[model samples]
Target chain A: MNKLAAKYLRPELVPTKACQGCAIGAIENWLLQAIDEMELKQEDVIFGAGIGCVGRQTFATWGGDNFGATHGRALAVATGLKVARPDKKILLVVGDGDAASIGASHLIHAARRNVGVTVICEDNMGYESTGGQFSPTTPAGYVTNSSPYGMAEQSFDPCDVVIAAGATFVAETTAVQWRQTVKVVKLAMQNDGFSFVHIRFPCVQNFGASALGSRDPLVSMEWIYDHTKGKTDDGAETDFAWETGIKHDASNSRPEYSKVLRDLNARVRADMAAGS
Target chain B: MALSEELVAPWAEWQESYQDGQRLLEAGTYALTEGAVAAGLGVFAGYPITPATDIAEYMSKRLPQIDGYYLQAEDELAGMHMCAGASLGGQKAMTATSGPGYTLMHDAYGWAIVNEIPVVVVDAMRVGPVSGITGAPGQGEFYVSRYCSHGGNIETIVLSPNSVQETFWLTIDAFNLAERFRTVVTILTDQVVADMFEDLFLPGDYGALSDIVVPRRHNLTMPFFPADSSEIDLPPNVIGEGTGVCVSPYTHTEEGYDIEEMEAQWSQTFRLINKIRHHKDEILRYEAVGLDDAEVIAVAYGATARTVKTAVLEARRQGVKAGFLRLISLWPFPDELFERDQPYLVCELNYDGQLVREVMRAAPDKNRVHFMGKSGEMHTVAEVCEALEGVAKHQKMPQQPYIWTEVR
Candidate 1:
């Protein structure tokens, strides 16, 4: 195993259950690299995972304290963990279905509360773990098991949703752009309040064949890069690119949920002491 | 100070916040909410549901006063998930909801059961097949509390409170039981009990709350919900406590790793079920009134039990031999408490008899069992007396059939 992988992952649970050439593996690698770059202790981080292909990576690889939350409840779980232990860093890892579909309310409210937690949503277009069902993020006219004829609804842009919901920092990246993914994750971790990173990638085993018209994982990666907008390391804008940069970065003036709670508690204690 | 004193000093400070003296007449829901605070509730997450909304509203105002956390989740599903998360974080966590919202919480409740995370879910039931009546009372969720969430053979610790005072004490008991069993403990109250106003006595002297045993970091490396029966009593380790324990909703092995083999599944499922079932004697609790020499016994629970008690007294005044058995612990179904030879009239607020079904199964004579139930309305004292009179006269009224109607 590589040094970065060995440092961030549990040794016995290495070589994840993710499918061959699946972006989830690459995304996990980038996340570990980001943690390594930040020099954060694995034990100090609490990882919350929702139910999906991306959620499976939490226990399968991440060496932190793992909370396998119910479908679409990873952020809510992370919120609780963050509040309970404000000194620790909480990271929520969920799939597109978890963040934008059933658990969409959690994502919006977590951002609205400005809780101190980082959310990383692995957007593979559809629910890949459940046999290629159409997710809320599956684009219009995309065909999958559930949307055989093609999805009628327009796809959701989670980055824009989180930004509107009052996230302190929001960004978009892809699995193929490992360095950019790491950079975005590092930025999110450094942010004071709710941070959201929407990582769009293809499900090589499921959605790749049906929706993206590609069976090869490399072809899927190429399709993701070619179809979306991206920015080079030097920060030059390009059309139809992967759009790999921070979309929103709010000032740290807004109080976090835990800090506000602590302040209120301190005030209450003071009132009690004054005996008024 | 010693090491143990250092560990307990924070709890001591929290206990000092407990107020003494009567807080005045309030709704049963207030008792529950205040009782949760008195029980050292560290976190409360809930969504707005009629009859149960006051519990959340009260917590929102009170929890922050003591540095406790209160979050109004987007919905009941998220609320329940938050409660599970908070509980797993070494806090006594709870959530409140009515029937419709309770239905949305089945998935998370099941997750808590499988992961063995302790949480208290307060269900103030209204009439329901789905949003049947928001204003009316019903004991319709009795079965749902026990058998909720899809899949096979799951048992839970369910406590039903029949009075405003019982609501307070039972809320504390609910948390205690949840902590003890390392499972979900549900406090099932109805709209009548939850919304009814009464003078609740706050104890003059408050004692230190019962300590919830959080597993030490050294012991957390083992399976959270150990498959071995002897080691099943250990509480789950809190996350971010330097206990890198992995908790999953799937059937998992001793090390908290997901496993799909039949033996592993059987061991895990068996442990989850038997952990509560084998301890039924400790879990099952009920109050029997005048069952000793009575010819007829009326079995009831929650708000309906209060009316049943009144009717029993009225029946005795009329020279009828009717007694009441008020069920406090609805699940683990107190089968041994039932007298097989005596005829029973199971009364509830729901049209379809949910609790009576359990009565029939537990009683030796199923033929002698009778059900008097109505939906979207509480049972009148006169109606219960009439049922007792009819049962005493040996004239069995036909079982009330469930009537389903759409309400806009």
Candidate 2:
């Protein structure tokens, strides 16, 4: 294990169950870099995860207090946990299916309430854990196992959705952009209200095989790099490009959801004392 | 009519310990809310639904006053998950909803149970397979509460409150059990009990009743799960306590990490099932009247118990030996109560006959157990009395309007 990972991750669970050549572990290392840069202890942060590849691989690897919530409900749990322990940083690592599909409502509502938590939505574009089914974040015209012909539906950006729902901080990065990913993650953790960091990574085993027509890690990495730069290796324009970087930066602009409750409690208790 | 009553519950002693309380008239929802507050509830997450909506309203106003949180979730699924999350973060959390919302909570409910997160869920049932009569009462979730989450290798604690006063004490009891068992405790109340105004006694100072309320304790050491043991009162694992505890929906190890091994599965299931199974006596609570010489007994729970108790008294007035058995604790089904070799008329608020099936499985003779199912409304005292009289005189229940007795 690397130095930063050894500092924050469980030694026994260091080699995550993520597939060989998959970027889940790499993205997790970037997250650890951010946490280490902030000088946060394992105890100072609580890791929450949703069900899917991202959730399973990253769940208990955080050698800290952590929870693997039911599919798509990690944000709901984070909202409650934030209310109970607002002093601690609650970070949720979830998949595209968890954040944008099954758990979309919770993601939207948590952002709307500006709950004090940082969400790392690790989008692999497909349900790679369940054998590469098409997800809501799967790019249009992409061929997943579930969408042999093509993903008929247009893909929606979770970053856009969270921004629309009033997320305090929103950022998007890809697997190849490790420096930007770590920097933005650090900024996301600093936000007192809801912070959503969308990191799209490659699934070499399934998504690479079906979408990129090869299971080679190099092929998938190069494809993601091309999409990030919006150009191919030969300088031709790519079909789609992810407009990466910090999309929104209204950090700590409003009181957090739990703070609102606490303030109400203070006011109500004051009135109760006055009435007595 | 005078009836010999035997009330069996821990709160009977709890009531004696805290006698210096104020008596006031309130709705069951108010008692439930105050009961949760008195039990050191730190968070209540819920969605507004009929009959149970008043609980959300009461929680919203009451929680803020006492340094507790009331989160109005986007839906019932989110509400229950939030409660589970709060409980994981070392708070005594609760959520209230009706049938439709309760069904939506199954996913999070399973997660909480498997992880042994302490939470209380109030399913104030309105009639439904899917949002039936919203304002009417029904005991439709009798079996659903036991198999609340999918999977058979688990046990649940479910209680039913017949009146407003009981709802208060029972809510506290539910919280205590949730802490002791380190699992979800469901209060399967109904519309009538949740909405009706009745006399409720609330202790003057909740802080003074520390002996009665189970305080939330955190497990800060290793072996977060202890899946091999059936022991009670092991402090629940908290997320922000730096315990490094791992909680998930999968079968887990003593250290709380998920494992797919069959040995791990067996050990976890043993702890989940046997914890309550071996300590059934601690979880059992019921009220019985005149079972010694009674020829037939009227069995019921929740709102249906209200009229059934009256009917049993009226049966005695009509020169028939009829007994009354009102179940307060519904799950870890008190099969011991049905040991008496006599006819049991299982009265419930659903025509689909849920409790009757359990009564059949428990009673000494399956043939002796009869169903008296009614839906959308409470059974009138007259109807229950007639059913008791008919069962006493004849071998079966007499044909009655809107009452379905066919259990097959």
Candidate 3:
């Protein structure tokens, strides 16, 4: 708050509606920093805020004017915004319950539409806001408000989903890796057509510790993702090729997309697939 | 000058609007095309549908002369998306359809709203309740227009043009209003307007559509974003590389990231709405024909409005002080117009009272607003005249439900 720190200080109030302590919050801080550092144009960008938490974030507190929409429907909404106002930079934010679940249809289709929009999904491995519940990203053995006796399902890998969905660009990172998350977020913005960035946000309080309050617990994500991230597919470090990728391929027509998804699902059952 | 029935073109010997609908059919299609052209509407991406199919036909045949783009989409969904995309590309764009196609466009409409992307949708209403009357003029989906897009946010600007001329006028206004407010707009007509023909002075260069301010697109570095602005409510959004960041559905902070920012953002969007609503004088547009000093006021919009106008004229000839208020702006519902000094008749062609409901919400005096409406079929001047006569004589009106939207 002091003038002395003001010169070096960066703005902290993010323009989105992410929940408190939600990994999505830092996106503003980092993105602002990137913009300031990169010196990009403010008029050139447009935003497409998808449904669920992202909807509230857009149509409200974002750069230029932003569009927001219903749950699991943000991608399609973004696709529309991008199409309607192609001159503006388009960026979409979504969540596991939103992107991996209800919005899957729109997510794949938007990428297929490919008019270019930045898409970032917050994967806490569970639906935390709708009450710590099971999500498409929930680990097979994880428990939630909905999944009582431990989830009998494995989480989806969104990166492979992007590549197969015909996304021009795709990457996966974690909120804890603030720098990397910021990098990908910025990069996704720069990518033409549909760009996907999956944030492996650890729901430390909800899914991991169930500590309604707070704790320092983190995902042993390093165990699942090879040090090489999701790209080194020589099995060099990532023995499970299916685990470390965007889960669905929307780019492939109808049949090929179905087959690739089916194969990806098989690996997920064995924990051999990537968690992001 | 008061428009005379004799002036109603096509010289149809038949006296009723329902019977002499030949003019209505051609008028609806021509007006839609002319409206688009007026708004600097340079693009029309659409898929053909019955009753609404002529919108595409007219555009395809006429847009080239105006240097407009008329491309048929793979389907209704894609057609709507193309409309949205073209708008973003800095072109006023539109599309037309009925129930089935309208359903497909729901997704596109939602996107247009959240992004404050203004678009005009011409939904020539057909039957519904699961595609009830596709080609027949059924006002079934009147209420559905509110829900056509996403985001529970309401107060969208939808107009109903009863006559062909009004259709042309409202179509141009759709683009103007959309660009002005940065929201989706609708010209909700029915088979009556869609399938009608009328002689209207098509405003040259989009019918005198000029001097309207369209928002300049702001990218990341527009300086408007993060506008070193000291104003409260919301910071200016800069749209460059990093500042453009990511905007998602998750509640995010003011910097364009999906963070825990719901409460903060909710206030901001409401502020946006407040900013627009406060300027009621600029947005409040409507017409009061034959109501200089009337005992009864028939308030309606779209094609229904045309009937109310006709009916009011018929009543006046019979010495009844009947008048009509053709509501131009449906959302930001013209409360001032209804609350003003006159008895009212709310008429529409829908099952439930949607437009009339808004009138009631505005002027809650209750007794003054005579809700005369119908839905199953379009209203004729003769029918409106009868409704006006019953309401004018202050007779205990029969409880017979209107076949169109016959409810209290």
The most accurate candidate by lDDT is 2
Better of 1 and 3 by lDDT: 1
Candidate 1 runs further than 4 Å off = A228-240, B1-23, B208-219, B230-232, B398-408
**Which of the two candidates, 1 or 3, achieves a greater DockQ against the reference?**
1
lDDT of 1 at A107: 92
Query: For candidate 1, lDDT tens digit of each residue in A1-276?
Result: 888778878888777778888878778788888998899998878877888888876554677678777788888777776777788888888899889998898899999989999899999889888889888888778889888899888776888898898989999887767788899899899887899999988798888889868789887876776655454345655334555678998836598878887888788777877995
RMSD to the hidden true structure, all candidates: 6.7, 1.2, 11.0
Query: Against the native chain B, what TM-score does each candidate's chain B reach?
Result: 0.89, 0.98, 0.79
**Model 2 chain B — which ten-residue stretch has the worst lDDT?**
B1-10
Give the better candidate number (2 or 3) by DockQ. Answer: 2
- TM-score of the candidate numbered 3? 0.67
How would you encode candidate 2's per-residue C-alpha lDDT over B116-170 as one tens digit per residue? 9999999999887898989999899999999998878999999999999999999
Q: In model 2, which residue pairs have backbone atoms overlapping below 3 Å?
A: none
Model 2 bad stretches (over 4 Å)? B1-3
Clashes of 1: 8
Candidate 3 Cα lDDT to native: 0.59
Q: Of the candidates shown, which would achieve the greatest TM-score relative to the real structure?
A: 2
Candidate 1's residue-wise lDDT over B1-408, tens digit each?
Answer: 111111111222433454566657889989998778777789899898998999988998788778898888888998988888887777788999999999999989888888888889999998877887789887888889988778975788899887787687777777777777888999999888999998786655444443432321223566655774633457666787666678777777776777789888888878888888788876766777677667788888888888888998899789888878888888878889775588898888876677887888889887777888777876778888877887777747433334221111
Q: In what order do the candidates fall by DockQ, top score first?
A: 2, 1, 3
